[model samples]
Target: MISATLGIEIERGVRKLLDEAGTSWPSELKVLVDRPAHPDHGEYSTNVSMLLAKTLRKSPMEIANKLKSELEHAKIAEGIFSKIEAVAPGFLNFAIDWNVWLNRHREYSAYQGETEKGKVVIEHTSINPNKSAHIGHLRNSCIGDTLARLLSRAGREVEIHNYIDDLGNQLADTVVGILHTKTEGEHVRFGDFCWDTYAKVNKVYKGSPELQEERTRVLHELEEGTSSTAWIGRLTAEKIVREQLHEMKAFGIGYDVLVWESRIVAEGLWEAAFEHLQATGAFYKVEEGKLAGCWVLRHGGEGSGEAEGTPSPDPEAHQADKVLVRSNGILTYTAKDIAYHLWKFGLLSQDFTYMPFADGVWSTDSQGQAMPFGRGETVINVIDYRQEYPQAMVKLALEALGYKEQAARLLHVSYGVVSLSPETAESLGVDTSAGKGSYAMSGRQGVGIKVAELLQVMEESIESKRSRQEGLSSREIAAAAIRYYLLKYHLQTEVVFDLRQATEVSGNSGVYLLYAYARAGSVLEKAGAGQKGSGKALMEPPVPSFDGGALEPPERQLLKQIAYWTETMDAAVRQLAPNLICSYAFELSLLFNNFYGACPILKGPDDRVELRVWLTWKFRETLGKALDVLGLPAPDRM
Candidate 1:
């Protein structure tokens, strides 16, 4: 992702200058290059000369003049940079030869067909196997799927993990409520039944302390593992989680590994984990205070309260620790997670007997058929941000246990939740006092819309649009539009869940982007196809020399945006945010729209036709790549 071509030249200039100055350094001296915020400030600017001014005891301007003079004498300076100019603030600005952009355009365009398998561990849609898939789950999967696609395209080995919370308080509640309610012959999906049972039980327990106590009692039984209640509880949870996974697959979400909480607990991983922590001098017993009888981990932190240069509350704070094993000798939730994290990094000498739940949920193969189960090399946990502390603690514990490298490898990829629609919130009588503000979805009392129902609405909207749209197959139009809308927006923002806007078949919706691709498809059909006819025949054209002579302002801008593909892929990988890619797609779409409106691809006859056709096909290919990164399908008809 070279931001500018002249940057490569400028780095060489700086390297030669540094060597000439007899300054020994480590690695390549990285001079930060950027496109200046103001167009008047030239295409690319660097502040390295200014940065060295203080050490050199010379004015930045004096240093800049020397580099400007030296860089002009460099071999690669020809055609890459038209002129080198210095600003009053000691910054160096370089004007680029637009021909260099044409070269970048061709370079990036080659990556379109590049196949990949380089490995990535993507953990997403880790919905607590307690209830149904809500809007928040949708957000997680959409972002995760898009990221997986981008990484795979950029050539990465991707392994998806869908973790289910198989043992917890919610599991107990659903088991108690659903088991009592279900009749002898109900053929309900576990998640669907859990959804109904959870909502009903939640509705009752919210106002009644007695009902709440009953739910807690069931949880204790599950924890204690003695009562028959525990048996039914675990089974009910397993079934429900299975149903949720099934629906997730229906909406194009799949995971290579399906990790469960119950199996780890059964294997005594937590017991072994507790011993590891104790041996590392990271744990001690809490003999006093409210935490009596608890085996707590030492906890302290840096703040104003701590002495200067000392971590306050210190890792030695209270001379006590966080309780790894709780008062009743029952393990806390944190303990289980610690064991799981250790196993993820292969630090734990423990293993789970991998069993197929056969819950009827499966991942896809290369041929669009079902491919079930895969072993993973890395693990990601997609949980709510509140768990960031717990996750951090897991990392800290790993480091304490001397798995410092493993600690560094863990990623807590958090995203804000999708909120309830305002009217839905009002209709459901949502409590504004939860302090989570709007990002709360209460599955109990039936507060949230199911993902299936939401998709159904989208599908119907697609059908309605298809019926009205002329000369297009219903299936093609419906799918293209739906997938595009799903991929169009940034996933980090808390979507307001506007049912109307989500279902609306036009304007920045996924369908609209698909329509744009479809429109490009129509143009290609009219011209007897663009890429296969010319791209294959063009013979890579000696680094694709373009005159910039025929490039309109719009064409230049489009080319400029097109050149950002490498950055988009790299940025998304580093940041772990698909929103970055989504933003790129939107920008690319807007650029293509303007280019299509202003410049005619086939207007000029003869040689111009092939070049413009090549450009048009390139645009389609680039646009198609953008959509592909988002896992949005590019249908020819739509």
Candidate 2:
């Protein structure tokens, strides 16, 4: 980022001079740079000289020669570069002042102050409480938690949220099966015990119209919030959901708000939103036709010229008319969701007072209670790719209400669903059909592995390895290693949960990067507390005086990479891709490895040795900061 920002500064300086030339030229002069593909070409190179060569009607070499004089005259890289020169291809390259660059690196990292404050909401790890957490859920939590950490680190007010759909047919089938049938009080922990039962019920419903009717009836009971079956559904859901949230917390996934469907109904938030829809003329009367008994909103009041061109049935046709009033004169799920989202954005016509959830069984803070609803400048929903459309509809409804800005902020962080390899499915003690019913995770059938147990296993492995190798204070090691593993992958990736790959020290794993840090720390420690660094071990700096004349190309390349980190971070935030930072951190490790192999830190007591010590320490500090951003810890020992 320093490199790029410097380029901008230099351009502004050069452009001003051009404007003063006062020729009949374009009002704004353009400056261009194409960073070197290899460090051998210098840190950054530009062919802008050649571009102007043709316009100035001179050979590129001559123009480049002219430009070098003009640029040097500008003194942009004054203390930052050793030289600014022209390469054979008419490329202009600037070599930064090595001491200045080193000093900048030290000062830059020390400036990471406290987190800023402003309301921010991040929704993740919202795996259906009905089932256990799986690898997909793992990705969501890793990303969501890491995002919060990054934003919080950069200084923002952040609140985490998880939405649970406790009232639905998916939960009902399980409750119905449990109600009529009796099981030993022994709870089968396939998520909500009743929810797991739904999967079993779905499987063998064959040739039994009676069972089919029962499921349909149960779903109705769920929707209407009536019958003994509905009560069981609610109880089982609240229990299982809380446990799953606790499991997610091991990896630092905790939400401040827990919004549930039942509460939305109890408050009648949807009914008010429906009234607003009617007032806004967004809902219509379905007088007659196949949908006669039901109401429907024609896409655009007529029909989508085809919501695409499949000439497909309105996906919402089979769906209720979004039925604010079902044929039975009650709200449907679609209507409820529309209303809930409006309330989420505080756009609903009527407000619902927060009732601190009773039972105290599931909430946030010490008492296990969550922050009551109605907050957040923006809401992000992390869901499986399949739910993309419904989530989009939530945003669409907000957009329809003339809250385009909020709708724009209504992000759906849709990700690929997790599915295990056939071999893994069998290993987990289950027969998995490639498709019929075998999928990543399904709360419906009560299938999938546990996420918390996975993290615990990973933690134990790391702890045991350290216990045998070296003594690191437990907190430092745990925080660093756990985050490193979770952040190694980018979000939106649906990895086939592979245990062997997760804990490996090499092969692109977080452990390997930590190993690198540990090695660097050992070298620094052996050099003694007073060895060219602050003995306090606090990462504070005056200015580093490294001699760049001894820096190999790889060392220079490493410096260049370090310089772009702020830019990489800004890009990561803008693109919503955690992997960019993840990949960059690893690449930095690789650079350090090469630099260390070629340049020894503890081997010399000469001026160069002290310089190498300074250089290595600077590298470690920068790498450490980048790792922290990725939710990874920098270990003092491998």
Candidate 3:
């Protein structure tokens, strides 16, 4: 907010200078105001003069001096800045008048201005309904859920969809294993039972071509939607989905809708999409050779140099065109995805029937009521980086059918895979004697950490070390620790999970932030400033007058950080990056801690106590909002 005010005044001053010289302002130039690294430079500084040197044909220092002189006498700048300085080498610095700012500045509120239009559909946690969810799946869920919260905070109508691929090969393999093989152990959940069965079936298929053919047969029956095998597949998928949702709820993740792949096929959405693509002349059939009888989409003269009517010389070569349908008349995963996206953007002629799945949640079914679920102006899919090719193909299909605007609005938020650190792998009973620094997770090999087991282990660890005086339960702390740990890294960086580092009570962790919030609450309660039955002090409108004349250095720094909350939130929403919020919250906590150690709130001098108390209240309010956006619980005491 401060930056916006400074940028306007600087631009007006620069324009006045340009008007006198008959100079037209450059349309592409933007004014950027930032906090300087040293306190001696003033509160905020701008280099607009340096940016205008080439256009004005003058030295930067001369322009800076003239602009500074023009700004000093401006009516709008009279009450805002105590001083405006022009330093060496073309830089303009401004020291704020704290008395005017504290009395007039608006408190932080979620932006509900011109940018908050249209509905956003975020599809995430689209795990295949075959086995239990692993640690990597947790990362995808955490990222997606936090994004939904952040967008909603910015006043966007957001809907979340969890796509379930029940008709895929993974579920087919799991069904064949469950019906044909015999297991040896007792299981508590159906998903856990399928985990072992899936591994066993893959092992047997390595040597037997007969089992591979049977797997293909199962896939066809599952698509037909009338056979006994299809019935078993439906039962299997629904059971696993229930278990997955249960685990996700423990970590504060929920969905508004569950879109099953079978419903899309049964409703003929894929058939409509196929016809639409064929009419555009980009989708065709391979007449002969290795890709004979298969429907393919050419890559717009890119990739392997095989033409539409030509036969490939090498059967094992990477094909230039993507096959949407195989010779046996079955749709590929990419083909189904193309159809789903068309419905998401409301380009398809058909829609799904919805039924209540849980409290305030809906699911697509063959027989239910019609509802308004799709037709999102913007769509974001949170899949891993490995699916980049398939995601691109989906976009290409949209463009081929002349839905170019929807194609441009489609976003693929790709992230890296998760691995286990050496110490964590050893704790999970994996063989770390090989001395590898990181171990990748694999479901086929049964070498991964399950979501349910991880939560239980983390909760037990927190309980063992927590003091009785702490006002939060172990489960609450565990959720905060895990969610923050997964979101602290950059989206594209490979996460190597370590339990010890995530649960630390000091240094840049969720526990540290929680402790700082509780400490402020404790101070307010002791001074009788807290309202009855509330964790925070009474925050009335039009901030109360305080002793700004006696402000200490630490107090000034804390106030600056508190004032940047709205700017930080705007940047996070524009970039669609949650790590920026994590960084801001951590730095804010550190500044508050510094002020706590240096200045007293309850035991301060009589004239300064009111200012210090108001500062602490603002810090708590700002930090609490940030915690909500990041999907971390903020307890008053912990």
Top lDDT model: 3
Cα RMSDs, all models: 5.9, 5.7, 3.1
Quote each prediction's TM-score. Answer: 0.81, 0.79, 0.92
lDDT of each: 0.64, 0.62, 0.83
* Ordered list by lDDT, greatest first: 3, 1, 2
What is the TM-score (0 to 1) of candidate 3?
Answer: 0.92
Poorest stretch of ten by lDDT in candidate 1: 363-372
Backbone collisions counted per model = 13, 19, 0
List runs of model 3 lying over 4 Å from the truth. 8-30, 70-79, 107-114, 301-318, 429-436, 533-550
Off by over 4 Å in 1: 4-12, 15-30, 36-44, 47-65, 76-119, 179-193, 206-213, 220-228, 301-322, 357-379, 427-439, 467-492, 505-507, 530-546
lDDT score, candidate 3, position 583: 91
Best by TM-score, which number? 3
Q: Candidate 3 lDDT, tens digit per residue, 106-153?
A: 532334332758999999999989999987998999999988998899
| Per-residue lDDT of model 2, residues 1-638, tens digit only | 44555567556644553455543334444666656786766666777666655455667777677667766666665456678788877878876676676656645344343332446677777555555666666777777777776666656677776766766656666666666544344554646355446566676466556877786777667666777777777777777776776666555455666667776776677767666666443365554445545543333421344432232244445343343455544455566677767776667655544334332323422233233455557766666677776666666666656677888877777666666655656766656654433346555455665565556566676666664655454434554454555555556665565555565556466766776776776676665524444434434323446567766676676776777676667666666667787888888888878888987766765665666565566667777877776666666655
Candidate 3: worst-modelled 10 consecutive residues by lDDT: 301-310
**Candidate 2 runs further than 4 Å off:** 1-4, 10-35, 45-73, 77-93, 106-118, 180-196, 223-227, 285-335, 349-374, 429-447, 456-487, 490-494, 530-542
